[model samples]
Target: MKKLLAFLTLGLLLFLAACSSEGGSAKEPGNNGDTSDSAENAEKQEVTFWHSMGGAGQEALNKIVEEYNTSQDGIQVNAEYQGTYDESLTKFNAVAGSDSAPSVIQTFEIGTMSMINSGQITPIQEFVDADSYDMSGLEENITNYYSLDGKFYSMPFNSSTPVMYYNKDAFKAAGLDPETPPATYEEVEEASKKIVESNPEMKGFALQAYGWLWEQLLANQGALLLNNDNGRTDTPTEIGWTEEEGKSILEWVKRMVDDETFANYGTNGDNMMAGFLAGDVSMFLQSSASSRDVIDNAPFEVGIAYLPHPEDKERQGVVIGGASLWMIDGKSEEEQKAAWEFMKYLQTPEIQAEWHVGTGYFAINPGAYEEQVVKDAHAEKPQLQVTVDQLQDTKASYATQGALMDMLPEGRKIMETALEKIYNGGDVDEAYNTAVEQFNVAIEQANAARGE
Candidate 1:
């Protein structure tokens, strides 16, 4: 009996020892951060990129990723579509709370400040300056919006400028030359009046009427949307768009709305494009990035022109639209290095040119224009050159300057509310003042949250 008892105790001891050993070797819940692994130390780096572009944009992005994946053996890229831009941002924020987030995220231009404030992104300046990467060919202008205080946190990939898209059929029907798009806001108003009076069946001028769109218009007139260095001063600030210039722009819009020259289309994000496609609207003011959709699906000849200015010769350069590629912070050094390499590869002239032509965005690499394919495309379609031509005379606007605030998206919502009021018979000045006040409150909240 003594011997049996000793044997049982020995067996229990051994079992406990085995269990302890197993516990010690198991990895703790691999807490996912901005980086899956250390980019420097990773042996095999797999870059996961979350983007909102689907269809043609997605296909083009995938082609670039595939080429990068095959061009080298050290790293592999995985691309995933996260729906629309807003949805992608929401998904990113949600994933950031867990351990399975992607390494690269594509975020819209306005979202940059919010993302920067979130501290989840790794600056690209480090990667671009790395000995392994060559950034000489990248244009300074394209990189302007992605930079903050001389440090680049993101790389400009699919950059676009807003332009005037007029339906040639509508123009001709209205007895206006399709080639002579409105050159100024006054011209636009006059043209809109004529077009509306001529074509009672369709709306004359269609604005996307989003807050961002409003900001763009304000910027065109040299107005500042936010007070603190236009959000670049790096401090808490309030919305200043209720000022004289901003109010004037809104009043102009109100006039158009009142005259029935403009159509709201009820915030169907896709409806503005649909309006153009269905011939329900005469012309559209949208980003050049939309060229692909119009070309691929429009029922008639689409005319592209530079965004009209408040003055004919004084058209302030329009701000860039579209998103940039941002690397999530906290990745393994190896992964970051690989991401850098892939970014450099993606920015090559050949790739940029092909992407710009395929996706209807301007190439971040100026040298991209020298490529044979780009030359051929520009020759074949002259309107595709409008973005480039306008950019030559471009100067960033006070309001259009890249925003740096956590509450900008909210501010945009406030402006949208103001727009809604204007379109729905509210006093334009009163609505704008209310929006400005509301945005200021949001700004204060954001600043407080950031402990600024």
Candidate 2:
């Protein structure tokens, strides 16, 4: 009876030992038995990036995103095309503060004020502060636009300025120097007349009724689009440009209209671009970002020049026209960090070179100019260098830093209407007065809405 009892005890001990061993084996070090933990470590943090890049810009951006995905194992970035800037912003408004919102969004320069007010974005300044990231290497003009009061609210990405695109062949035919394109409004006017004289079939110039172009034209003449130092110091309440400064542009257009040298593609940039491509227009003002498309598609030799200023006023330069990447709020810290990493990757010299050459957008990182790809591209298309030079030569000023206001998009529409009226031979004084009154009302309404 004693032996049997001992045997039972031994069996019980053996069974307990076996159970312990099995349980220990399941969680042994380096063993993937705990799938939850393994997955947590192995899964990559996903970043959703919403952008408005289309055509060549979209292609280049997608390539960069793919490279970024493969380059790292910890994070994967998914870039979503969200259509035009205005359209994307509208969609963002719908999804903001919800899970449907993107991790990062690309907003245009003018949307800076709106984005800041939306309360849906975590300013990139937070990331910069946390990471001790140095932003000094970026182009000052670009950084200047995104920065307010010495703090960067967003990451400057695809930046561009307005430039005058002209046909070198047409300039030569007009008995003008192809190497020296128009430098002033008067010069442009003169060039336009010559171009018309040379080819009755071709219009001298076509200024698309684009509000952004109007703003740039004002900036080029050292005129602000809003008061209080372009709303950088304080909220604006009225028109910033003088009556004369604003009227000069109107008068210039009126002269072209009267002379039949202006091609009125009312608010249709696409049609204006088509006109240039079809050799129906000799010279036009457009974003430098279009440089690649214009140079590539045009059969005639293309020449890019600085945005023309009034002959009386010194050239103050152009405001950055493209968009910046904003980090959306409500995302996980890990996700925001991951998105920030992607943003940093984009600002690298190699990537900037690719973006600049691919889309003709200014490389926010000046170091990109040193890349061999940029060197080769500049060698092939010297006109690309003109865009760079123009940006670099821009004299820093409040006007050039651009205006900040939520109503800018609305204001642009107002200006567009005024420009169309002028293009159609409407009375300049009437158009200007109506535009000013409407613009002031917009500013006042925006301020009232903000309770400022």
Candidate 3:
């Protein structure tokens, strides 16, 4: 009942704007095969798509929109570049009270639960079911993350996984086989020790103090990042870092820091990458989405491999780390249908392949590998295939499905803070308990705010 009240309150903000005289009857300029804007008789549907991507990613998105616009004369989608993911979500929520929200928006995986709770989204399942769309070509593991209650809430896009990136030259110099990178945590430690022992000036590895990496480590071990099946069964009440998997990761990191085999490069992946490129470190773990820039900019030869798993466990899986397209609720049926059409157009093999080649993100559509562009790129850079195989082979599990808590973003903050505490001579048990207590407080507060 509380949640419903909050939903009503949210709807009230946009109610007046939605009922405004212009909003009730205003129509977009139709593309009706006529070059002139004077084709008043042609019916036009407009969709606003807000996103946080910029640079090469943004360029690819714009190209896709352009192609879609030219391919149809019924709907015209205006792609707006909002700031970061957080900023875009914030702007979206701020305007939730008004009828100014975009017809569709791109939100990062972290915001999935909050978006659902906001009660302002029309699940993609509704439209797909209405048309009986074929989704067999899409990667199941990638789609699993955006799904809830046994259905997809949004359309997956620009998906990625974390991979171990090593310097081939460093491996060879350390008398290790460049082709055989570390496959287990013990192997990583062995290689790092050798590299550092051989070259005292260079460090073995430097992991960014990042929540995503921490979460991936748990996923790699098939450990849930939170309880209640990552909060899918119920709202997550606390953090999961004090669990066995999380403890093992923290201990390993602490041991490495003490042994001088690893160092925390703060919370920035860019800094970690810079250290690797500058020969200060031999190995770094980063998102596969960064492959293009790392390969193009690094001075030394680069090698990619699935992230190291604990010796006890095989590489079970990794979580997706990108954004998905969500159709906002409260739009006209025509606008909603048009948004669905644009989404389907983007999923075509040719466009997905183009997106994969242009940006480093994987094509969510499995069939996209058959496209000439993807095949040609694979021929040129075989390392790209490593990432695709990783996602394709990852087995579906609660851990790999990724966390679904409404307090996920806040939970990550708590985990990162606790990580910093661990690195700074704080007691792991103490830090863990404190994080749980604090995180639950945050959850309760958030729940109260939402009337959940």
Q: How do the predictions measure up, each by TM-score?
A: 0.85, 0.91, 0.88
Alpha-carbon lDDT of model 1:
0.77
Q: If ranked by lDDT, best first, what sequence of candidates would result?
A: 2, 3, 1
Give the per-residue lDDT of model 1 (tens digit) for 1-452.
99999999999999999999987766556543324535422555788888888878888888888777667668888888999888999888887735577888889887888787667888888776766455545765567666677678788888887888888888888889998998887788888888887888788777765777777777776667777667766575676554776676677778888888987764554898898899888777787888777866888988888777666335566666778888888788887777777777778889998898889888888889999999998888777888788765677544555566667788778877887777777898699778777888898898888777
Alpha-carbon RMSD to native, per candidate: 7.0, 8.9, 10.8
List runs of model 1 lying over 4 Å from the truth: 1-44, 97-99, 132-136, 311-313, 397-399
Candidate 3 backbone collisions, by pair: 13-97, 14-97
Best by TM-score: 2
333-387 in candidate 3: lDDT tens per residue? 9889999998998888889999999988999888899998889998888889999
Q: Largest lDDT belongs to which candidate?
A: 2
* Model 2 misplaced regions, further than 4 Å: 1-42
Error of 2 at 327 (Å): 0.8
Q: lDDT per prediction?
A: 0.77, 0.93, 0.84
Backbone clash pairs for candidate 2 read none
Predict model 2's lDDT versus the native. 0.93
